[model samples]
Target: MSDPHEQTHIDSVGSYVKILLALLVATGVTTAVARLDLGAFNTVVALSIASVKMLLVALFFMHIRHSNKLTKLVVAGGLLWLAILLLLTMTDFATRGILGVPGK
Candidate 1:
């Protein structure tokens, strides 16, 4: 008998092709955007594009879109941990100026 817990989602080749094309287009857009002078917004735009690309890869290529609840929970937890770490790092950097130089 087959296992009931197994994943049954099967993507077609066309879907994979479509995802590939989309990733390529996003990459091209990222490259093009990098050349423009958007000042501080450049990093924001680049990271936004990158986040979209990451989601596409995760949801489609990694098959997370159809994954089980446990898998989804694990992914969510990982993202939360990453967010926490980033927040802590940013907090440290933001507070660095508050501490005067040791010798000064």
Candidate 2:
């Protein structure tokens, strides 16, 4: 017969409370950062916070921490693809000067 102790169980109430507290703190910090007038960097700051929150959600809420290597690889690939997309978009936007493109 299979041993109960060998299998992983879902998190209990205390564990959930801890995760919720962390999320609450992150939300508060993000809110505070939004109040600052960072001008062009505002989007950058907001995205950074969002990415951190995404990590938290993935690791905890999604229970990926206890998942296998293949799942981790899939998550990494998704993040890498998003990074590539952002890079290409930034390159295109920053290089418009070379092509004599009209004002947007």
Candidate 3:
């Protein structure tokens, strides 16, 4: 009988190569997107693309796809923390100009 605790997933070289190609294509797309002027949406678009690339790298290259549920939960928690920090930072930046200083 095989042990349940052992990791059975063995990814192929071809799959890794494909993921690498996809990552390269995503990078090219990011660069292309940066050239155009999209105003406020430019930041949104860039962040969206970056998030996709981050997921791909984490899921495939980092083997998170084959990880157990607990590991996935931990990753989710980390991402949530990052989101909270970014939200706070953006909020602070957005409100900075709302209250004017006496001198300026």
Report every candidate's CA lDDT. 0.95, 0.84, 0.91
lDDT of 3 by residue, 1-104 (tens): 76777547989999999988988998999899999999998899988988888988999988999988999999999989999999999999989989898998
RMSD of each: 2.3, 3.9, 2.8
Q: Is candidate 1 or candidate 3 better by lDDT?
A: 1
lDDT of 2 by residue, 1-104 (tens): 65664466577888878878887888898889899999999899888877888888888889898777889899899989999999999998888778775785
lDDT of 3: 0.91
List clashing residue pairs in candidate 1.
none
Best by TM-score: 1
Q: lDDT per residue, candidate 1, 1-104, as tens digits?
A: 65777848799999999999999999999999999999999999999999999999999999999998999999999999999999999999989989799898
Candidate 2, residue 25: lDDT: 88
List where candidate 2 sits over 4 angstroms from the true fold: 1-6, 39-41, 98-104
- TM-score per candidate, in order? 0.86, 0.74, 0.81
- Number of the top-ranking candidate, with lDDT as the measure: 1
Best first by lDDT, ranked = 1, 3, 2
Could you tell me the TM-score of candidate 3?
Answer: 0.81
